[model samples]
Target: MVSTAPFEEQAFGRYRLLERLGEGGMAEVFRAKSFGVEGFEKIVAIKRILPRLARYRDFVAMFVREAKVLVRLSHANVVQVFDLGRVEGKGDEPPAYFMAMEYIAGLDLATMLTRCQQVGVRPPPGLATYVAAEVAKGLDHAHRRRGEGGQPMGLVHRDVSPQNILLSWEGEVKVTDFGIAKARDSFEVNSEDSRVKLLRGKYAYMSPEQARGRDVGQDTDLYSLGVVLYEILSGANPFRAPQPLETMRRVCQADAPPLERLVPGLDPGLVAVVRQAMAPLPSGRFVDAAAMHEALLPHLSARHGRFGPSDLADFLRRLSEQLATNRVPVSEKTPIAAPSHLTHDVDHDRTDVDLPDRDDEMAQASRLLVLGRDLLLQGDLPRAGDALGRVLVMAERHGASAQASQARMYLGYLDALAGLPGGEALLRDGLAEAAAQGHRAGARQGRFLLGRLLENIGLPRAALVEYEACRRLAITDDDPLLATECDEALARLA
Candidate 1:
């Protein structure tokens, strides 16, 4: 596919952006190559904040803060951040803030789950537990991290979703994305007036305390890690509701269906571990991530007899091959060529063909939505508003109700930020449409945003109602993050 092709070798400091690897709401990642004297070349993943965000002082501060935090976190199970600085933009473009990190030649836990679902294969029980255990170890390190003077850093990784956990072909599991992490000694502490809202993590994976916008500690990270473990074993998040409010409700109630019921023949002991880790109240959970890791070790030993890193490596490699062979071919129009210095590993190459496959109108709408989201994150309100408007028009014309709802939600967010009219109505309509379509995740997001907007507009009573609804939904969906956010909003009202 033409999208895969390296249009040109673009230099950013010593690193050359060889190919676009992926894009997210806040940043774009590239497969970059850094060269040194005597033919020393290293491949790194370069995450650059979008142009719009890079120009914002608040966003720039957050990016720099993330780098500072990562620099202090040294652990085998945590992805290392190698370098951080600004790369001068081309022509009239602004300087781009970038971070060079260790590149794992493998898929994230989320993609691995999708692969397992597509192949109708449950990952080996031992492997699943092992991966989760490794993640817990990483969390333990972060939770107990100390500062230069031996003072407790009190670091809590607010975001611990599947996308942040990477599993390499060599069987290394690393936890990443401390961008929203909270630590006492960190350069930036999250405040109510922060550019980004108080709620920081993925809604589905947040702990109850986090969801409520309450102060989080090590236990919060444990709860999220438990959610990750549960999904790894069952291939579904326990508290994934159709609406943010519902998800919050589920998280508050800790009302996940029994694991054995979801995955038949799952070990009872394993289920117990998950239940304890996911307990709504912090006191009911594991003492720390270390304790959770200890709990899982025996289970791993019992299920798959003598399995180790090599076993995981072999399984991942085989799975990668199988997935590649069965993957849908991308259009020939978007050809991608890897940099000569980079090795063509199966795990890396497999992610090269993630382009959308749809009709022209749908594809165009999707592109517009992404552009709108990126622009919004970067604080380009007017341009983002226009792009989102186009998305809504295209989606409505194409009868893509879900896409239309999403566009409406983005526009609503923009309006809310801009203190414009129709924000509440647009958000409500979007949430209702998402719920009608069984897009619980989307609905959940909409509700959360709406609740925040209402609060910002001094509608405490209305905001409380929305937050309460979100808390209930979060509990039903077993989402601690949403639940905690609701709790926090409700607390503020109190």
Candidate 2:
């Protein structure tokens, strides 16, 4: 469990840190309360560069430069950047860079997808279209932004995955994470080196040009948005593969299966819209984000009768209610004292804790599992591995077999990421355990991850078997995302 001591006492500028919401490789986010005179207080999200990364001049410059552009953006569909500055660290420590932005009190698209899987329902097609269209509107704004001299800024959001698309409880769709965005006036000192050193966005959502390391413009963002739309409407990414290299290959070749093949009754016109947005060549795609947004509007309005934020808000409210009752409740019993060995610090002076009994240990294990997953998504592999390892140990010791299997599944993915051996064994064991326990979701995830690992290891035939198995499981379990993923993988292998 994360200790609240450090965060409770920390203050970045006028924002008093309340809790560590989540973290990624480059930065950590905190839910903070900003103070002002006359009892004025507002909750905000404070994103700060990781301490170790602060010393990297290139990354620091990019962070500041991105903040400059973000601060100038104001749109209902975009998260507003309120303040950007450096906070002095304690003692002789170097100052930390931070940006306070509008805090969104809702789930990201990824989390919402998971929630949908849990509840056995997907968002309505109209609602999905609306969300994607809203994102396109935001991208259009950034794409057409002007500089101090009213010159075109030519901003391109390099990263436009589900994680960066937030859906508020009030049904607001907001696009965030401009940290990797490319703009005409960017302050990046070494653009070529930066591009070569790191791939900016998620591989599954990257455009063909981006996957090929070529120059990207507004069209690239539209392509990424198309992927998001496809996932939302059909419950899967069309170009996704079991491995990054394979996924990139499929992307470069534009090898996604037709939408109707996955979502059998999907509207042909809607499919055409997505196809145009995700066209293999930039020249074949929509001219800009605005054109794409306009194309989606008529379809959205026709199918869902004046669909808007209120309609989405109502849908989300219902989903939340369903999830509230369906989700496993975390143990509310007081946390036991931590064992000496488990008391080591993890980050921001926050120490880990070990509970005394099985119930408490299981609770702690669950929390650690979520923490590890978040870290993994953020590309902090080392810390993610450590957290998942702890979960495995704790779950095993407490006789939480199902939880242990979950931990093993993630550990297997980490192994694949590191190109280490034994990932197959871990996934196989986890899959068996999940199956025995009737955990369909866990079982499907295990198969999916295993397929990825197998493909990455040059075992294409074996990967096909796993993907086929997952496809069957997805169909039986009514999981569109898993089914779509399997379809994409099968298409690549074919």
Candidate 3:
């Protein structure tokens, strides 16, 4: 597939551009075929320095340094930089400074997340961990790579945001774009600019020190990557605000909202790993990305076990109930009236009748959902389907809004996964109800699932719309791979 945007055919020496891949803070990447020896045609990425930043001495210095640093990195997970030069197009003015390198045929983490949101799916825990492990292996390699004088490179990827991480379609996590990489031997801070407030890297993923533009070390990268890991596991950002300044302030001071608060019944072990990795103090967090991965190892291993439909359903049910309960107005929960016989009767009906009854239904529905989850988790598809089937009946009979919505959603999920009859219609109807109830989260999830369904049906454009909605409701940057895939899908359509 090719992009519709116009691009030069050739840039720099020995590289004929094919299409524009993407643009970043420092460079614009393009897909190009290397004009290597005969019988050896290779697809490489050609990254040209952005014209706007060319005049900045420090920025240009960083670009040149990045090219040199990249040559030293020989890891499989790091995109290889092959050649660098300046090139002038036919009749074009000043030459463009560009680097030709290996081209990864996969979407970056950002696109993956968008795709996942479109499809209403999060990668399984084991897969997410496996991806993380790959990234860690790459980072570890770069960090440990020896420089001139046989000294430790001590390379820190100060900007480890999802956009900089590529989760290839072939199931590999490759870290890319190291323009701001901090290598112990190569970088020197400019004292004159020390007082300048320059918020480097993506604000959303910045560590406290990075946000504050203070001297940062490997721990800063680790903390940033921890935020990435947190997003992948919990599907929510640890710290977020409406504006960049506010978000930076939160990164500097606020505690991350608990994982259970976003997705209840998530493995507590996973939450602990994420929380520990994202600790406010550098000392409180993992010493490195490898340590962060180690913290999540146990949970990742456990996730390998089968997940039945019932277990998934139960998880969603419990999660939904928790979310709904959190929505109850504080005033509504306050004591309504003085204790009189008439007030007592009304109170009894409201509290005991309505609230407890709702609670009972939620509990019952949650149990049934759990049963379904266990069955699904265990890979008992038929039994899981049967379990969810029962919840569907109960939800319809008892009029449990949260449970009913959940049950419908699960039933739709199982049917789609099972390739059962009328699954699309079922999912569509459930999504409508979820939307009508103003369950934005539920609606977001539903749209994601629906978008995936649409994609399966060859409706990529519709799927993109669904993913866009999903992103609006995304609580965290977790599942970027899914979003990236959605973008890839859209790209295909484009």
Candidate 4:
């Protein structure tokens, strides 16, 4: 699929992008604040597929179907999906899609663990069990979610790691990032292609079957949760190794030291629970996520009397006060009530321009960068120059290096299309900047554009080098369409 072009609106369906939280191989996650009538402002996390991969109909359709199935999942322990939407392609541009989800104000388990490591304090044993118990409840809910017809959805959260376990400032645990989640019904759609059953996740958190690329079920989520529990209590991932292949081998063979042995004096009961949940065979593990939660509840009570969200909240509060640090990280601050001076204005930039918080501005800059590119594609050079130039200024002001690189790249392409000098140098510099920042997709795009330029200038060998590099990247990203394009380019050169 030859996917291209930009969004018509600056804000994606009226949810103003606040910050680019993170990006994965498949999608980019953004923190957005939605505005509605009568002072209604709601924070949501938006996960959108990368524009480069937007036209992969089979993959996008699979994600859309899973999103529809995910909307049915409503549990206190699971993060909610407020909306799922798609924008139709206009002319050469392929459709863009997104899913808006409940945003957690605090941090993930991984971040919390890092903070604890920096402060030299492992979480209390009871709290560890409590966190896992909460996650188990969420998993149970996801696994047993039913369709509108009352039949089982059989959802399996393929990626259940410490990073996916969100802890609110109020100490509530919510399972998040059902991005790679698979519904049982999804298998029948593309069962002919074995890649349909493939699961991608951190090797240390994967179940034996999952690590071996076999069929996964609800039990797979429980196994990953067990890894989380083990990490929390023992302060180490059981199968973690310096090398990826070694790590996979360890995970598949269950070749790790016993948790109790690794952390001396760890409650024997807790040890038993982790070991059983992480059993090599699916049958050896707990019957379901609910059973694991039940097993963990007693440990939570026995170790710390009546442990709950309040207790977790208190611990986080006290830790924040006690821990001394210099670097800014996600704050665990939770307000009891909205301030009296809060305004109903939807214009976030006006309120935050003077403040040190630049997420809103950065989001605005990102939007402009896209708009500039869209205008360039639409042959509106003057407007594209204005928008791209403004984005460069905003990117520099906020120190958003990646955005700055992209802005320069588009501006260079714009200049070339309009018969200007120094375009090639700017494109090369932008590609170099992107490479330094590890933006593989952006760098590959720059290479592809550079290849076109070189080919136009009667330099087939140089163009071949650039297209070859892009082919490798396409293969690495698992973008078959792009790989095929690169193959066609190479064939022409040959």
Best by TM-score: 2
Estimated TM-score per prediction?
0.63, 0.65, 0.59, 0.60
Q: Give candidate 1's whole-model lDDT.
A: 0.74
Q: Write the per-residue lDDT of candidate 4 for residues 124-241, one digit (tens) a residue.
A: 6777888999999988888887878999977888888888899888999999867454432233333565555332468889888988889988898888888889888766677765
Give the local distance difference test score of model 2. 0.76
* lDDT, residue 78, model 1: 94
Would you list the rank order by TM-score, best first? 2, 1, 4, 3
User: Which digits, one per residue and each the tens of the lDDT, describe model 2 over residues 251-287?
Assistant: 8887776666556566788999999988999999999
lDDT of 3 by residue, 404-492 (tens): 67567666766776778988778788878877987665566576667766776678888878877775555354545345434544565
What digit string (tens of lDDT, one per residue) describes model 1 on residues 336-407? 211212223323344344432456456546545655654664567776776677668767766888888988
Clash tally, candidates in order: 45, 0, 46, 0
lDDT score, candidate 4: 0.73
> Which number leads on lDDT?
2
Off by over 4 Å in 4: 1-10, 88-93, 179-199, 302-304, 322-494
